[model samples]
Structures are given as C-alpha cells and as structure tokens.
Target chain A: MSVKLTEDMLKALPDSRGHFGAFGGRFVSETLMDSLMTLEREYLRLKEDPEFQATFDKDLADYVGRPSPLYFAERLTREAGGAQIWLKREDLNHTGAHKVNNTIGQALLASFLGKKRVIAETGAGQHGVATATVCARLGLECHVFMGSEDVKRQSLNVYRMKLLGATVHSVESGTKTLKDAMNDAMRDWVANVDDTFYIIGTVAGPHPYPLLVRDFQSVIGRELREQSVAQAGRLPDALVACVGGGSNAIGMFYPFLGDESVQLYGVEAGGLGIDSGQHAAPLCAGRPGVLHGNRTYLMEDENGQIAGTHSVSAGLDYPGVGPEHAWLKDIGRANYVSVTDEEALDGFRKLTRIEGIMPALESAHAVAYGLKLAATMDKDQVLVINVSGRGDKDIHTIAQLDGIEI
Target chain B: MSRIEGVLKALKSQGRKALIPFVTAGDPHPDETVALMHALVAAGSDIIELGVPFSDPMADGPVIQLACERALKHGTSLRRVIAMVKEFRETDTETPVVLMGYLNPMEAMGYETFADAAADAGIDGILTVDLPPEEADEVAPLFAARNLDPIFLLAPTTTDERIRAISEHSSGYVYYVSIKGVTGSASIDVDEVARKVAHVHELTALPVGVGFGIRDAETAAAVGRVSDGVIVGSVLVDTIARHQTDPKALHQALTDLLNPMRKALDSLAQ
Candidate 1:
C-alpha cells in the first residue's frame, strides 16, 4: 500500500481548497468562512513576498533562538549498542518547545493583519506559553483556553501564562481537555472575528491553519536538512518525533517527505497499553471523521462521538491528529507507532541518566520508540530523535510516580 | 417536490413566514422528544428542525452544548434520532422534519448508509452545521439521490459569490445565522439581518430562514418581517433545561414560550 512520493508532492499538497486528499477542508460554520478566506488571501500574498519571509527569518533567528542544535548522544548511542543516536535540541528553544517556531510566525502574521487580540488553546500549556510570549512581545491582548483538568495538571505553566499577561480560561466542557479547549477557542474566535486572531498551536484546525502552521513549523525539517549535511555528512536513516496534534512531528517531517531513503516515524502516547484500550494512539486505532474543523483520523465511538483519550503525557491526550499526518499514513509515506506509559517513563529516565538530558514526557514517547528502533539497526546506521521540550515542566509528574513530594 | 419545498411554497402562497422550532432529539428524555415534536407542530410551527446531538458541538453556545450533553447522556445516537423521526412520522407526516447538527455523527454512520437510513426513516431535509458546500459534494449527492433536501447555512459574512456557490448545492432553504456568534447569543441587530437577508435574496431564489438569536416574540416578529422563516433554537432548549424535571411543566413552558412567537409571526401576514 506504500506509494512512492513524487518530488512534486512536497510543493503540490492541500490543493486549492486545503484538502490533503479528503483528510482536510474547512468544516467550520458559515460565519468563519469569510474570515478564513480573508486569512487565506493574505497568507497567499505574504507567503510569496520576500520581505515577509525575511521578517519571519529575522524573528526566528533573533527572538526564537533558531537553528537549534543537532547533537550526537555518544553515551546514549553506546548504551543502545546498535545505531548511532542523535538528538534535535528543540528543548533549548526560547519557550522550551518547537511550539514557538510556529507561534512567532503566526504572531507576525497577526501583526500584519492588524489583529490586536489573540486567543489560543493548550493542553500541556507549551502552546499557550509560546502564544502568550509572542503576544506580549507584539503588544497583543492574549486569552488562552485550557481544560479545567489540565489547569490542575499543568498549573505551573498556567501561572507562567498569567505572568506573561495572558488571561487563562478554564474550559469545563467536553472531556475537559485539549479538544474542548479548542472548541472554546473556536467559539471565542467566531464571536470576536473582527479583531481577534486565533493562534492554533498545532498543524490542525481548518484550512489555512493546518497549511500555515505546517509551513511555519517546517523550519524544523528545513534546519535539520542543512544541519545533518554539515554535522553528519548525510541525512539520518530514520527520523522520530512525538505526535500529539502532530505539530512537532510534521514540522520535522515536511521537508523530508520526498527523501524516500529516509524513514520517518511518529510516536503516539500509548498510555497503559493499546490492547488495554487506555491510549491516545489515534492514527493506529482510529477512523476517519470530522472534528475541530478538519476531517482526520479520530478516536471516536461507534456513534461518531469523539472518545475520551488517555495519556500520561498531557500533550498527546487528544482524540484527533493533524490532517497531513493522516494523508501520510494513508499513503504509507510515514510510519506511526506507540509506546506505553511504562516504556515512556523508562525512556524519560534513561535519557536523563545516560545523556545528562531530561526530555519532556511528550518527547519521551519518541525517545522510547527511537531506542527500540536503534537496537534493531546496524551500528553504521544513524537515527535522530526530536527532544521536543525540556523536562523541567514534568518534574512533578515524575516525582509523583516515584512517591516523592516535589 | 420535496416535502420541505411543499411546506415553504404553501406558506408563501398563504403569505405566512415559517416558524421553525429547533429541539434536540433526546433532550429532557428520549421518551419526551416524539411528543415534543408533536407539540411543536401543534404550536403552529411550519417546519420542525430536530437537532442530532454530538459529543462536541463546536458551533453551539452554552445552552445547546449542554443540551447535546444531556441528550448524549441518554445515548442519543444518530440512529436513535432517525428512529425518533420515524416514530414522529407515524402520527403526522405533513410537517416537514429537518435534522440539524454537526457532521461527525452522520459521517460515523457513513454517508450512503445515513442517507438511505434517513430517507427510510421519513426524514425530509438535513442541515449538517459543519459541512459547508465546499465539503458537501460527497454527501450532498448521496442525500439528493435519497430524495433528501440538503440544507446549507449562509452567514452574515458570506460573500455574494459564495452565496451563489452555496445556493447551487442547497435545496430546502438557506439558514442565515443572524449573528456572527454561536447559538444562544444575545441581541441581533434586526436592521443588519434585514440587509444581509436581502443580499442573499439577490443571489438565491431559495427561502431564507434567520436563526442564532431569535429569543422572544418581538425578535421573531421583527425577523419574520425580513425573511421567509424564523428559526428559534437556544431559547426552546433553554426552556427544556429549566423545566425538564416536570413533564407537565415542560409541556406548558414550551407552549407558553412558542405560542406568543407563533401568534406574532402570524400577525406579520396582515
């Protein structure tokens, strides 16, 4: 079922209507259509202009601390005892995740559009912090919607958002998680469409959003391309990144879509286990359905009602994935796998002790999968795992597991 | 002609606007919905808009979102909603029943399966909130093949060009959202809705129904004067939320709330 991607596949996607082969389109209401069209028009024009590209590059380099390092984990590679393991150090970014790469681009777009207010939704609060950081820099009023459950789980990040001058709204709606927070953010955007720009954190949501977010976040893959050639003399044999709403993974995978020699893997949060039915691996075990403005693979019940998802890592506790990932999965362009919570926790501690680097629980999923893949490969082969965020935010979660008071 | 067209044409001939009342299929209780459909038809409604409950109603406000939750707690799947419409059909088949909600539940049932099931269940029209014309091609053909009128929404912000596009895909009528917000919002400017409805009229010959903020008899009357239909949803769901415990009170509250709006709309004919 795996069809080889043509070279033009990289530039030809989404078509004129934002569909990544029946996976995406604007499935929003009539009210949002006009604003989305205006956004699409503006984006199309700005995407072609050299000045806008220059401005984006300037912000990414100066404000976002871009060209994040690609480092070789010698100790971890020796421990794995098979393939040489490398890491993309997105954790050292300004906001501690790859989320800022997209946020800075969107905030620039918001400024160009003259939208003075911004709204965002978050689960692990990385996206919220990233959005608030950029909004504060641009002097834009920022409002963030977070599920009430997440408000308790990630309270430190919530406080950080507050300190950044963003008003955090606890969304007590369906499942009390990322999906509901997204629903509330859409509601806020619909109501205040005139002056408010919605900064969707992931490569999800409606038309221009999935396309634009991927374009902004694609800096990861573009940078990795050059950095690999410089540091390792070639692209790694395999690339791995964790998939929540799939922003980080897609960011790192977009530029390599046509690199057929390089294998791409997206790791999903497997919670207890896939067989236990307590996981958030939608691409592995979901059907096609429409939710949150895009038709993608979703964890839904037989009635088409979205199912509640469980993941130890809050970032991957989502029902649906990005549409581009869905298209890739269908076409066999990329492989998706899941690691159980126990495996992820082990991965978290292993990298910390072996490499003196603690990865966020979300990134630990990729680390867990990458280690297993590395063990099966030849020692000459290379593997790069995205250390998507720092583990400083996950200390409490890890501490509670060990029965230690923080 | 489709039942929706017959009803609207008959109303146009009589010089009366459509008083379309929207209610969730299993709100209050699953047992109460069929009878509630009867009550809405009896309360001078021209068409009945039955809401299919979804787990996440992104387009709705607090009122309808809570209503969807209440309905889902009873396990009101799309099949159950279709069965409810079938039950309503047994008593009175003249009143056109239009199922309204987001697209996921119907997509879950498969477009072909859902269209066939709905047609067999005596459904007349469908208004999937999230499925706009650009995304409606696959399902719209299936619905049309099944003789179901594929309804579409036209917002205040829709351009003239897009209005023509939506009109080409829509059959029953164009639902015009009176406000830029979700359902159950407060206060729509009557004159603004009047202007937008007029703009839609210039592009499509289909009947226009305004909804999203029509709460009281006064707003209904004011909106009825400008468009062919007035859709009231959140206020009725709000009534169900308030008096759901007492069946007798629920019936009375619905009648009391709807009768005034019905009478006011009828007065527009004069």
Candidate 2:
C-alpha cells in the first residue's frame, strides 16, 4: 500500500514513538528507556522546525558538499548495453563515505542537546572514523567503540579514528563484532545519559534515530531530485543502492517512495552465495524478530539469538536492517536483490578501469547489480546508481582477492 | 474472586503491602521450583511471578542470567512451565501466578494459543520484558479477553505521558521498577519507587509492584510502606545458583531467603 506522499502530513507523523508500521519502537533496558525518550522528544522538535532544515541544508551545501552531481556513464552504458547508468556521487562527500552526512547532523543535534561526549559504534570502521572526524571538528569529546574482530580486520580505520583524536575502545561481547559493539555503545549512552550522545551509523536503532538518520541522509535523495531533473529532464527509470543496515539505500529510495513509476532496487551483499549460510541477506533468508529495538527481518537462530553473518565488504556484514526497509520490503515498494562477492569485485574493477571512479566495496555491490540489470533493459531507460562511498578503504580487502594496484 | 485476589485485597484493606516473590521455574529442577513457590507463598507471598527461562535475556543481570542458564541446561521451557502451573493449580488456586519472560516464545506459540493455555493452567497474568505498553495493544487484549490480567511495568524514568499510556493499558497491576537498571543490582532507589507509584496511582487505580533491587527485609518493608507490592528477584535466583546440584539445599536456601521478606511483609499485613 503506497500512500500518496503529502509532504505536510507525512512529516507530521514521523513514526510517532518510532512505530514504522509495527516495526520500530522502544524495546530497551530500563536504563536506556529515559535517555532515549528524552532524545526522542528533542529530535522530533528539531526535525519539524524549518530553521533546522535550513541550517542542515546550508551546511550540506557549503560544508558537506550537497547537490552532488549525476554523471551519466556513457562508456559503461554501451558496455552493459541495456540502460543508461548515472552515478550520484555521495562518495565525493568530505569523509569518503556517505556516513559523514548523518554524523555531522547528529553531532550538531548532540551539541544542541547540550551533550559534550559522543559515543559511536562502527562495523566497517567508516562510521567510526567519520564520527570521530566530525566530533573532533565540532570540539566534542569522542569515544569510538569497535568490535574486536572489526578492529583486527580494519585496523587502519581504527588508527585513523585515534588519529582524529578519539579514544577507540574494542568491545568484546556477543559476537565480538558490529552488533556487539553497538550494544556496548548503547550501554555507555545509557550509563552516561547526562553527558553523552550516541552517533549511530545507520538508519537503525530505537525511536527518532531511524527517522533522524534518514532525515539527515535524505540529502542524497533531495539533491537527486534537483540534479536528475536537470540532467535527464525527468526522474530516472530506477534508483539503485546497496542495503546493509540500509542507510544509503534509504537515503536514495525514500524521496522516490511516492513516485510510483520509479523502480527501486536494494542490492544486498551475497558474500559467498545465498547457500553459504553466511551471507547477510535478511530479506531473502530471515524472519521477523526484535533486534536493536526494531522488529525487522533478522539473521536469527532457532532460539532467536543474533546469528553470525558474512559479506566480503565489512559495511555489508550486518544481520538486521533498519525497520523502514523491513516495512518497505513487506509492502513491495522496493525490490531487494543480492549480488555475489565475485560480481561485486568485477563491478569494482569495471567502474575503476572504465569510469575512472574507485567505488567503495559497499557501493560496488550496487554497481554489480546494475551491470546485470542494465544489460537487459532498453538504451533509453535511465538508471540512477548511488555511489555510496569511495573505494580507498576497500583496496586492502580487494587486494586479498586480486591486486587492483595498477 | 480468586483466593489470591481475596488474600491480597484483604491485606490491602488493612493498609498492608503485598510481598510478591519471583522464582524462576525449573531452576536446577522442576520439583524444586514447585517447593520454592509453595514455601514463598506460605512464608507470605501475595502474588507470584515465575520467570520462564530464555536463551538471550537482555534485561536480566548476572544472577538471573545464571538462573536462566541453569534452567535451560535442565530442559525447561514455556511448555514445562505451564505444566508446573497446572500441577500447582490442583492444590492452591488462589495465589495469582504471573509468568514473566520475553515475547518470542509466546508470540511463536501464537498469542491466542498461549493465552488459552495460560488461562487453563490457572495463570493470573504475564509480564513480557520486551513488549512495551505501546506494542502491547494486541498482546494485552489477548490476555484480557481470556480473563488473564496483562501486568505492565512503569520504570523510574517513565514520563507522565508514558506512565499514563502504560496505566491505561495495564490489567492486574503495574510493575514499578525501583532502580533505573536491570534486575539484580546492588542498590534500590526507595524515593524513585515512591514517586513512580504515586505517579501511576494518579493515572490509574491499579496496584503498583516494585522490583529489580530489593535485597533484604528492610528494603522490602520500606518499599511496601509506599507501594501496593514488593517483588524480590535476584536474591532468590542467587539461592538456586548457589545450590545447583543439591535440591534439598536449594529448597532450604529458597525458604531461608523468603522467610525474612515474608516476615517483614507479614508485620505490615498485621
């Protein structure tokens, strides 16, 4: 059921207490209940105000580089032969990945709430580094929480966060990975509610966060609205982005949710393959359960414990997604598909060699899906690809597979 | 009215407090859980909240976590817990037994099926740790339609609006968590408990039960002086954790732990 997007009415609702069609609500411990409630109230007030939007927009334009161009890939299109492919360069944002957009907005909101210390959890280390960079620039005390496994894998990003003047703490709980790191970060925010703000990476978490992060990341969609019309004289035939915790996909898909004609494709990472029992394809091989305060399709065991997940890209290793994606998948508004690790590496190489643009491993997953779909569609058909982040961080991960040095 | 209702109401009539004890079912063994529940009621429990073991219990502290681990090791489940309640129902039907746990098993079994089974087993209510009042719209009605009370919780930091929301949805009574923490903690906030109880009383006439950190008789009596019920958990779970293999020692340990809080509540009752 696609509801007509009334900008005024929909903006007013905003998951009143984060109930996105029974997917999002506050399901936390007693200690977090109060802090989350307080933040929820404040965030709603700020998001509804026009001045906050103006300030956010101005910062996005002048500071974070908004209105990121839609560059059509002519050579790549001929090679694929189906549809004309366009890239929305969010990777060109100040901090490599699309993470900075939301982090900058949340850090400001944190400061607005009179919070001094910022705590964050990172999986791919992009979010942690971005949060540390923004917090350092904003003069806030920053503490980054990393899963021990992620710290071992993404040690360079860990060092980058520390170099940005943030204290990085390795969390050793649950799976000793992203989800566990998020839990520990939440524990800290709960314990130190008076002075801390949790700079969540994705459009996941309890009330206001899913809404807040989406609002901040909406710059991707809003800019696409103006840029796409200017370039193609109309909206693209489809909007495609990778979905992990689903920040970038949401950032690209939401503004087009009301546009019935635009096909939306969310590419999930098929690490080895769907049959491997390790891929983080929740929509394809999962059930609805409550995790991280939202009821969504989660990679859960028979006992409902958070099971381990795998994806070659560190950013795409999460088991559950933002609750909004769950609702979208249920309603059939967006098509959630998958691409194998081998296909993603091929896309990463193709984009680099052909378009001269190095794409993030997370973004390469989307490019890989486009490569297959574009070959089958008409030449006049337009496809908008959200280049989520730059591929500099993934050079190491890619090197292990095959050398991309030259 | 049921015997447990009559007993609690009569105690309340005298301006007495309700001493509600929480014991994990089948901790160490099922038979010991039965003995412990009976002893606690005899010793002076106005109501009983039996914790159904789950694998990933997020809100629980170390003591309760250990209790759940032990119970799971011995093959305890929601099915076995209901069976234990049915056995208890044949003897004493008055003492209200509320099954407190997470929402998955109940949701997995289907709400109506679980409600029917619980009502048939003589369960008075349920308190799912993860299901908040907002999401309990469908769930609370499931129990209420089956004549089973859906007990809700009000935390120390719950706002006036949330307190009203929870109060409006509650059935049997409201569980007022004493501290701003999980179950089994070192300190009890007596002031916050009184404040929350008063806050809930303003919105609804439901009895308020305080839990999470009441360790001894003094804390129980103090909380009882202000609230309608005093719930003691971790300490009882700790009792089972200490006597893992010895059932007699576990029973004795449970009895010893209950006697003091029971004595304190009994004094308030008289």
| TM-score winner | 1
What does candidate 2's lDDT look like per residue over A1-406, in tens digits?
5555556744553457687775877766555677877888888788787887787778778877877778999988988988999999988988788899899889989888999999998998999989999888889999998889888878779989999999999976556678877766765665566788999999888787888899889889988988888898888888899999999999998888878888989999888988898788887788888877677788866545467888888888888898888888887788899998888899999999999999998999999999888987888889989999999887778776675643
Candidate 2 fraction of reference contacts recovered: 0.18
Which lDDT tens digits does candidate 1 get at residues A71-134?
9999998888888899999999998999999999899899999999999999999999999999
Local error of candidate 1 at residue A218 (angstroms): 1.2
For the candidates in turn, chain A alone yields TM-scores of 0.99, 0.96
Using lDDT as the measure, which candidate wins?
1
The positional error of residue A164 in candidate 2, measured at the CA in angstroms, is 3.4
TM-score of each: 0.99, 0.87
DockQ of 1: 0.90
Model 1 misplaced regions, further than 4 Å: none
Q: What ranges in model 2 sit over 4 Å off?
A: A1-17, A26-41, A48-50, A167-169, A301-306, A352-358, A395-406, B2-4, B13-16, B23-46, B53-58, B62-84, B87-94, B195-204, B238-249, B267-270
Q: Chain B in candidate 2 has what TM-score?
A: 0.94
